[model samples]
Target chain A: EAGVTQSPTHLIKTRGQQATLRCSPISGHTSVYWYQQALGLGLQFLLWYDEGEERNRGNFPPRFSGRQFPNYSSELNVNALELEDSALYLCASSLVYEQYFGPGTRLTVT
Target chain B: EDQVTQSPEALRLQEGESSSLNCSYTVSGLRGLFWYRQDPGKGPEFLFTLYSAGEEKEKERLKATLTKKESFLHITAPKPEDSATYLCAVQAVFHAGKSTFGDGTTLTVKP
Candidate 1:
């Protein structure tokens, strides 16, 4: 089976702009999770989506939001992006316990 | 509130040398603990999952064990390819929807 896939392997956006990152879950997977790994920092949870519903989110601000489609694909949108938003955005897919991650999208905010 | 911490921010070892990385956690209602391997400029790859205390899992040269307060990833006769950051995360049984993760330990193995 194909693993989790993400689009735009690398992205560059200016400050105050809006950035959109996409994730397509593996076949037969229903849950998609978004995480951000800042430079020299650990992975921080962003959002969780299951069956096209927003399930849970982390302590991040409301500017970081996302949605899951019926097909189990997800899109993470960051409005008013700041320089700190430059990080590797990862997406994982899971059915019950273990989560399989994608290659990740490297976002650079200038 | 749940918290996770890892010891030895970074470690360097020689090929064939064995060592262990620690992941200490404090959370209510332990559900499961997960181990992952992450390489530079890449995403984390799933390694193993432990459900309860005293549980153990192994793959290749790596073995993961879980206890009430901590988890350990032991590398037996590691290789240079095993050099990567190892991450540990835990989720509460009541709230498996989300998880708490440690900062992770970076391991570098030299030939």
Candidate 2:
């Protein structure tokens, strides 16, 4: 079975612009999570979606939002992207306890 | 709040050297503790998941053990290919499916 897959691989946007990253979870997985890994800053949880519902979120600002699709795929949207938003955005899908991560999309804000 | 801390920010060892990385965590109720290996510019590869204290799992040359407050990833006779960052995360029962991850330990196995 294929692991989680992410789209765009990399994204570039100017400050104040909006960016969107997509992720497709493994088959049979229902929980999708988003994380941001900045340089020096460890992986920080952004959002969690289960069965197409927003389950939980992290301490990130309101500009960070996402939604899970019916098929378990997810999209993370960052509004008014700031230079500090330049980081690797990772997506993971879990069946129960363990989570499998995607390659992640590297977002760069200029 | 759930939190995770990994020690020895970075480690370097000989090709045949054996060492263990540590992960300490604090949570309301630990649902599970996870270990993952990540290569540069790539996604993390699942290594092991320990659900409770005293639980142990092994794969190839890597063995993972969990305690009530921490987890250990023991690498036996590690090879250069084992060089990568090891990440530790924990899921809390109160948070449902959410997980908190540590900064990770960067390991370099010299050949």
Candidate 3:
């Protein structure tokens, strides 16, 4: 089966700009999760979406937000991006317990 | 709060050498513990999931075992291709959909 897939392998944006990253979950999966991995750091949970509803979010600021569509795809939007926002953003889809990840989108903010 | 901690930030092993990576976690209610392998600049690849203590799962040269407070990924007779960062994550029963991940253990196997 095809695993989770993300678009825009790499994205570059300047500070104060907005960036959008997209993810498509595996077939038959309804839960999509977003995470950020900064260099030398662990994965920080960003948001969780199930059945097109936002279930939970991490400690990130309000400027970091996202939504899940009816088809179980998700989009992460970072408004007023900062240099600190530069990191690898990962998307995951869960069937039950185990989550399958997609090749992350690398966002570089200058 | 749910938290996951992985130890021995890095490890170097010669081909055929065996070792183990540790993941310690604390959560309100344990739902499942997952192990994943991640290559540089790539996403995590799921390996195994342990739902309860004393659970064990194996694939190829990797064996994952779970305990009450921690889990271990044992690599036996590893190859150079096994080199990558191994990540551990835990989902709390209450949280349902969210998981907390560890910083991960970087393993380097040399021929």
Candidate 4:
């Protein structure tokens, strides 16, 4: 079975612009999670969606939001992107605790 | 809030050397502990998952063991290819098993 897949391996956007990243979970997975990893930093939780419902969010600002589709794919949206938002945005899919991650989309805000 | 901390920010060993990495955690109620290996520019690859204290899991040359407050990843006769960042994560039962990740320990094996 294919693991999680992400789109737009790299994204470039100017500050104050918007950015969107997409993810497709492995078949039979119902939970999708979004995480951000800045250079030299740990993974920070962003959002969690289960069964098409927003289940949890991290300490990130309101500008960070996402939604899961009916088929378990997910999209992460960053509004009014800031230079600090330049990082690797990773998407993961799982049934419960053990999540399988995607290659991730590297977003660079200029 | 659930938290995780990994030690030895970085480690260097000779090929065939054996060592262990540590992952300390604090959670309301641990649902599971996970281990992953990540390359410099790629997503993490799943390694193992331990559900409770005293639980152990192994894969290839890596063995992961868990206790109430921490987990340890033991690597034996590591090869250069085994060099990569090792990450530990914990899921809290109250949080419905959502994971809290550690910054990770980067390992480098010399030829």
Candidate with best lDDT: 3
The models' CA-based lDDT, in order, is 0.93, 0.93, 0.95, 0.93
> How do the residues A1-110 of candidate 1 rate in per-residue lDDT, one tens digit apiece?
89999989999999999999999999999999999999988888889899899988899999999999888999999999999999999999999978899999999999
Model 4: per-residue Cα lDDT over A10-101, one tens digit each: 99999999999999999999999999999989998899999999998888999999898898899999999999999999999898678999
lDDT of 4 by residue, B43-110 (tens): 99999999989999988899999999999999999999999999999889888636799999999999
Q: For candidate 1 chain B, which ten residues in a row score worst on lDDT?
A: B91-100
DockQ of each: 0.75, 0.85, 0.88, 0.76
* Residue pairs clashing, model 1: none
For residues B1-111, what per-residue lDDT tens digits would candidate 1 score against the true structure? 888999889999999999999999998998889999999998899999999899999999999999999999999999999999999998887665687789999999999
Off by over 4 Å in 3: none
Task: Give me the displacement of residue A91 in model 4, in angstroms.
Answer: 0.3
Chain B TM-score of candidate number 1: 0.97
Interface CA RMSD, all predictions? 1.0, 0.9, 0.7, 1.1
Task: Indicate the residue-level lDDT of A109 in model 4.
Answer: 97
List TM-scores for all candidates, in order.
0.98, 0.98, 0.98, 0.98
DockQ of 3: 0.88
**A1-110, model 2: which lDDT tens digit per residue?**
99899999999999999999999999999999898999877888899999999988899999999898888899999999999999999999988878899999999999
The local distance difference test score of model 4 is 0.93
Residue-level lDDT of model 3, residues A1-110, one tens digit each, is 88899999999999999999999999999999999999989999999999999999899999999999999999999999999999999999987878899999999999
Clashing pairs in 4: none
Residue range B1-111, candidate 3, lDDT tens digits: 999999989999999999999999999989999999999999999999999999999999999999999999999999999999999999999987888999999999999
